[model samples]
Target: MPLVRVDAVAADPQQLDAIGDAVHAALVDGFGIPADDRFQVLRGAAGDRVVYDPGFRGVDRDDGAVFVQVFLRRGRTDEQKRAFYRALAKHAGLAGIEPRNLVVALTENGLADWSFGNGEAQYLDDPPS
Candidate 1:
């Protein structure tokens, strides 16, 4: 399971929802995560509220830049991560976001780090393979 947070600069409500769906689709197709295991928080930030270097990493970004952060369990290979990035860009681009404006960060943790209500570490009891 992955928890995704998307912050788009100068995006509207419809774009935010499309971005969320795009991210979820990437998670499922690229990472092989369950399609129904989607959890996300999408927010639209004003242009002035976001800060970025237009030429950072040799990519030309603008006010339409989007920042995505994902938190999930650790186990996926480096190859998987690379594929996920590509898949995310393709999906997000289809949602009208420029591929160059997309920024994704993944944070990995262990099963013990999660608590899905009831104060229980649910995955600890029966871990994923």
Candidate 2:
């Protein structure tokens, strides 16, 4: 399962929902994640609270920048990761997110790093098929 965090500036509920759905779609299509394995935290901060370098990496960002972070178990190949990035950006863009303003980061861990509930590492205790 991948835990997704999306931080945007002055986004509405519909926009947040669209972005979250786009992320889930990318995860399922690009990372081979199950369609129902959705876990997300979507936050829309004030414009001042969401800061970014307008020219970071030569990409011109703006006040409408969005930051997306995904945490998941490690094992995907480099090709898969590249495809995921592309797919994510495409899906998010279709949701009205700007390409240059979209920032995505992925953090991968192992099976022992997750706990669904009951204060237990579910992945370790009962691996998914």
> Which candidate has the top score in TM-score?
1
lDDT agreement of model 1 with the native: 0.92
lDDT (10s digit) by residue, model 1, range 1-129: 899999999889999999999999999988999989999999999644788899999999998999999999998899999999999999988999999999899999999999889989999997877
| Candidate 2 residue spans exceeding 4 A from truth | none
Query: TM-score of predicted model 1?
Result: 0.95
lDDT of 2 at 73: 89
Q: Which ten residues in a row have the lowest lDDT in candidate 2?
A: 43-52
Local accuracy of candidate 2 as per-residue lDDT tens digits, 19-48: 898889899989999898999999888544
Error of 2 at 4 (Å): 0.3
CA lDDT of every candidate:
0.92, 0.87
Report each candidate's C-alpha RMSD, comma-separated, in the order given. 1.3, 1.4
Backbone clashes, each candidate: 0, 0
